[model samples]
Target chain A: MYNPQAENIIIVKDLVKKFGSFYANDHLSFEVKKGEIFGFLGANGAGKTTAIKILCGLSYPTSGKLNVGGFDIYKEREKIKRNIGYMSQKFSLYDDLTVFENIRFYAGIYGLRRKEIEERAASLMQKLDMKEARDKLIRSIPLGWKQKLAFSVAIIHNPKIVFLDEPTGGVDPVTRRQFWDMIFEASSEGITVFVTTHYMDEAEYCDRVSIMVDGRIAALDTPDNLKKHYGAGSMNEVFLKLARVKVE
Target chain B: MKRFLGFVVKEFYHIFRDYRTLLILFGLPAIQLLLFGFVITNEIKDARIAILDQSKDEVTRRISEKVLSSGYFILDKNLTSYKEIEQVFRQGNIRLVLVFGPDFSKNLDKTGNARVQIIGDASDPNTANILVNYLQGILSNYLISLNAEKIPMQIVPEVRMMYNGQMKGVYMFVPGLMAMLLMLISALMTSLSITKEKELGTMELLLVSPLKPIQIIIGKVFPYVFLAFIDACIIIILGNTVFGVPVVGSVGLLLLESFLYICMALSLGILISTITSSQQIAMMLSLVALMLPTILLSGFIFPVENMPWILQVFCHIMPPKYFITIIKSIMLQGNGFRYIALETGIMAGFTLFFIFLSVKKFKIRLA
Candidate 1:
């Protein structure tokens, strides 16, 4: 099902997001190819979230030529929204809803049919080995399970692109590994994975990562190439070296 | 439509799953109605009173009998001297003391005016004021009856409390309760629910989905419309059965007017959610902005005409004021649509205006 043409799933040229006098995402540009695991690496307040929000259509950019899933971010927000999925840093599942009900709700809002929603929910629960927790309330489950369930539900509609903002902030090493495995599985299935994280270790897992510093993309390339260029042994050292410089 | 239904079903889960919120939503109206009906009341029954009849004559005896037979007062003491009236009132059992001047029958026959002084315990001023009015009403009716037979030139200016003859406090409270409770449940609940989604970060997910902003708002508010409607019904039914408040006009019209008011309150809730970012702020805004006005300025407990000019202007702007008027006219006066057309129109106008404002304020993109 993957697109073989290697078309850019997201295109941004000179994007500027300003809040009053502050440039939250100042003069940023990047592109993500189809089915690519593109990492958005930045320290806190480095505008990774602002850029992601603009790209997800949750917000409007002050000035930009931007497109996501072949739809203009400005005039085609609804169309873009239908084609993209987002999971915020905060847990997205309703604590009151059961696992199955949460999945059904998200799928239903995406216009999935009743049979399709049921089938997908069952398959998703089985895939996550959470069939026993299907009828359990989200709050009764563990935080790791809730985060995993949130990501599964976000992409249940099979959107062309999925945005994960710090999806694995507090999960244990084992669950974080499982989460990355899930991301890789999704990326292999031709779903463009655009994720933001402060964890530099997670940066190495991306096929190509863009490091944003002070509202601008300071570096954009594959992990090995970035490590080689910066003369650093790890992505962490590379990020620290890049972020230490003040972008004036 | 299916998406909206799904959202509404989820909302029901949220409401029913939280037993505390559920209790507040359903139990509060019943408790408030009972409290206002039984505890805080204006109607008096079997109040202990003393009669100080100084004349001890036929006319005085007949008037005393009339006063005792009214069923509003039970004779606690009958004093022969004016000095005992103060002692009876100080004992506090007697809410009112009827003091008749000496030679009452001789004075009425010679001058056509008998002096019957009514002294009421003024510690509880509202009850005392109402008791005094009751005594005055009874005295006037007696005088009118006396004039019908003996005096042809006397003008007694007859007074009748139309719709609420006994002046039952529940008659006044049912409509006000409906307004206040409906505003509380509909506006406050919806605002909190929507703001809760924002606070929990679920709103970002929904906004990024295929669901439109209007759909999200209506879906959030739909369950409250149903809940608030049930609350309105509960208040009316309790007011009717427990307190014997009448629904003299059309029940359908009353319910329809209540539904219009609920819509107005629900839209007001959506407007609140759009302006606030958290549930606490939404709750505070709903209570401080909606509750106080519904109670104080809406003619619920206090009459709008009695308020100061500035407050009267505020009362005119209050939607509950119009809703209370509409319900009172329909439920008490047995009034038709024509009698409450203006109030109904104003309520509909408020609903539309709030809907318009919330729609305008609902941002597609996060600000």
Candidate 2:
């Protein structure tokens, strides 16, 4: 069951995931609101993927009070799975499958009917201006196009929230802009976007950004507020100020 | 159920699209079976030998004729002296040297015994041993016929090879081939396909979907079951038509047993995928852990009884050993359920054990 009244789509409190004695995610708490672009920024080993996986129901938390898309993380994992979509840092589409086939397969697994899958797939191809690539295998496409198609396929079922873990990692600058434009379009359509990225310039695009350092959030605020608070000119400078001291 | 079907359809796409997978799935089985049947066999034929006939008597000539005409050996040279025995064997084309003692007919009639020195080249010991056995068989049969009227109270043991009358190597290889091919295609290919999803990061997307873990596993494994069953059929048909290996038992029983074996291999594949995160690791594990034991210790190429006792213990645990036994009994011996009941039960036990372990080891969530 969905809670239409719940403003925060993802709520986490004291979330912790441990590996033996090492805490991959330590006391991480944040809230992602409905229809908002939330940027989760961190360094390579700062546990951004761990938190994203936990929120997407791809991993269990060691101990936490968490809910995703209004479903209890512990008790209603299957429900959480139905209500959200995830795109990992690695390319998510099957390389051997054609674009339309990839779209149809992922959509079908989420319980979409055949007609629904075909209809949505055709419309998605039109929206992305990818009619020529519809029959092309994913491996034949460019990495930027693959990432974009992966994002579209992830949200093919119109889930309440979509989680992108470094979706634009290897994409060129022009394609990254286009990718973000697609993200904005999805958010405008009332889908909450929870994206994790190490690129600081990408951070300025989010409505609000949280920077994690050493398995804990170092700062959380709007991009401009963090810049002004840290007396920096850009989000990059703010990030350096937040994470550099801890690095030393 | 629809979702599961769609997942299986996707799995078929993955399998059919890759040319390498297609080659490995269908091509390897035929090639391996033919190779095992014709090229790599234990049966010796047309082995060359040198005969030294010191006695110009009828008995020695008949014995030499019997040895050379048995079709197992060809006369390379007729040596005139004992010194030529070492030289002929050293020449290396001849596999054996048959040296008949001088005055052989006189000695056998007067002393009731004669020495025929059979010196075999033991460099390739197995072939040498087989040639010696064939020569002995021919000589003993000739002696039996020569003494038939004189000896009336000799107790001759009647040996009847029960199932394989010709003792064709092909009959043995058909079952062994089925076990190996099914295990390889079912276990190695399935493990690779599943771990491929993990390696390429598509597993993360799959894990987030509404499809449960069990659904994902079954979907991934279902297509391989179909493919491996087809492989089993191909091997059986080829073995029957090409090698004339009989399927004397009920075809339904044979198929049921093959289905059970394929299930066991598929479950083992799932177990391997759960433990390893990379396709390379899964492949290595399947090859090293499954293929070697199936070929060496499962009574495939080497008889398990002839192996070391420790290896026999290992063979008992090898799932393929029971399967090979079941197949041989069913295909060659034409036995019904009652005859191979213990082996069938053991195979079922292995299938259940592997399924249980894989389910227990399966990760509900990515770690």
Candidate 3:
């Protein structure tokens, strides 16, 4: 796959998002290449969700130079939005709708035609081996299946960049592995993946991961390299060491 | 445009697929309209009254017959003593009591006037007042028929009921029903729609979608507008069939007014949803803010003109007040566009203001 060069798919300079007296995201800057599995690692309230929100065009940056998919977020928000698919930590899906219906609804909103939606949904379900559950309501499925389905629906239209915010939250280990396989599959097809996770172990799956502490990037590197550089045996130990250093 | 339509379709699916919301959206208005139109009304009909005849004379009997035949009161019991009055009222059926003095015919024959005491249950002041007024009118009419001596009265007051000729309770209630039903359905629907997203976690999903803040709000509100219209139709139909309230004005004009009112209510609902993150809060706010004001301040059950100045001013700000006035004028008085244009304009202004406010608030939340 063709990877993005210094021309970053996502580029942020001194990004700041404040909620009243509290700065949710403080002077944060980051860059991700095209076709990169960029893991955004942070503890709860580390501004991971806030940063993802800005990148996905859901919220405004207080003062920042932010660009995603070659479009400025402020003026070209519509263009930026069109290029990204976001699955929030909640595994947001309509519980009342069947799996097929949910897929169609999302696809339709993305302006996909009926035939395109049908073809895409069929292939995606086939890949997930979710044909039997396709007609069942989303609420009836297991949490693991729902999380995977949510991730699948997020990128159903094949956005240039897919953002998964804690996508494996509350899911089983097996499901997490299966989910990573899907992410890798998307990356192999030249789709860039940006994911946020509290699970430090899952950070190992990212091609390059950025660890955020107190709304700033405390560390950014490949998981193997981060472990080696920190003199740690695993990504979790590296995350813990970085978190302690930042707190100090 | 296709994307917007798709968003709206998803909204409809959310509404229709939830049987609870569907029932409330469609069923609530129907039930409320029926209840307001038929069950609860101010028009006094077949009220049971007790009569005590101490004279047992012809004049007393003739007057009692007149009272019973007026259709306002039904002579349910003949009480021998005054002690039975409290018992009759406590039973809750008797609303009026007429007590005749011992010299009923003697006084009338000697001075052309007889003393009769009218005792009414004042627990419900409005019902008591109406019953008393109705009894006085019947008595006055009976006396006029008995003696044809025309005495020139000093003050000849010509009272004209402008809008409703008979001042039918249904005429007043139809418009009130429209305001109430629209508020209930619109507010409930919008609140539920917002809460459903929060509950299902789809709001975060939509926030992350390519849809703009405005598009998401429009998508959520669009289906409710259609649902509110359906509720309006149900109320109108119920008002006509059950209450015999004729729509005097142009149906088109009434509908236009109703549309503006629905928009105002829907915008208010959207505004409430923005402040409240839960369905329970939405429902409570809708009920307290929308329902009560629509009922009490909009001339639905009580006259706005009769309220205190502060309450009257508050009523002026309520969208339903203007809507009720326009609707009542149209449905009862057959008022043309020229007559109700000001009220309709006011309603449109409110709709615009609410929409503007909600959009501003929504944008602020996103920002």
DockQ of each: 0.74, 0.78, 0.69
For every model in order, the fraction of real contacts preserved is 0.86, 0.90, 0.74
Worst 10 residues of 2 chain A by lDDT: A1-10
lDDT of candidate 3 over B203-234, digit per residue (tens): 87787777777788888888888988877888
Q: Which pairs clash in the backbone of model 3? A: B248-B334
Full candidate order by DockQ, most accurate first: 2, 1, 3
From the highest TM-score down, the ranking of the candidates is 2, 3, 1
Q: What tens digits encode model 1's per-residue C-alpha lDDT throughout B125-169? A: 988898888888888777777678777687656689889998778
Full-model lDDT for every candidate = 0.89, 0.90, 0.85
TM-score of the first chain alone, every candidate: 0.97, 0.96, 0.95
lDDT of 1 by residue, A223-246 (tens): 999999999999999998997776
Better of 2 and 3 by lDDT: 2
Q: In model 2 chain B, where is the ten-residue run with the lowest total lDDT? A: B358-367
Could you tell me how far off, in angstroms, the CA of residue B271 lies in candidate 3 after the best superposition? 2.1
Q: Is candidate 1 or candidate 3 better by lDDT?
A: 1
TM-score for each candidate, following the candidate numbering: 0.90, 0.96, 0.94
Which has the greatest DockQ?
Answer: 2
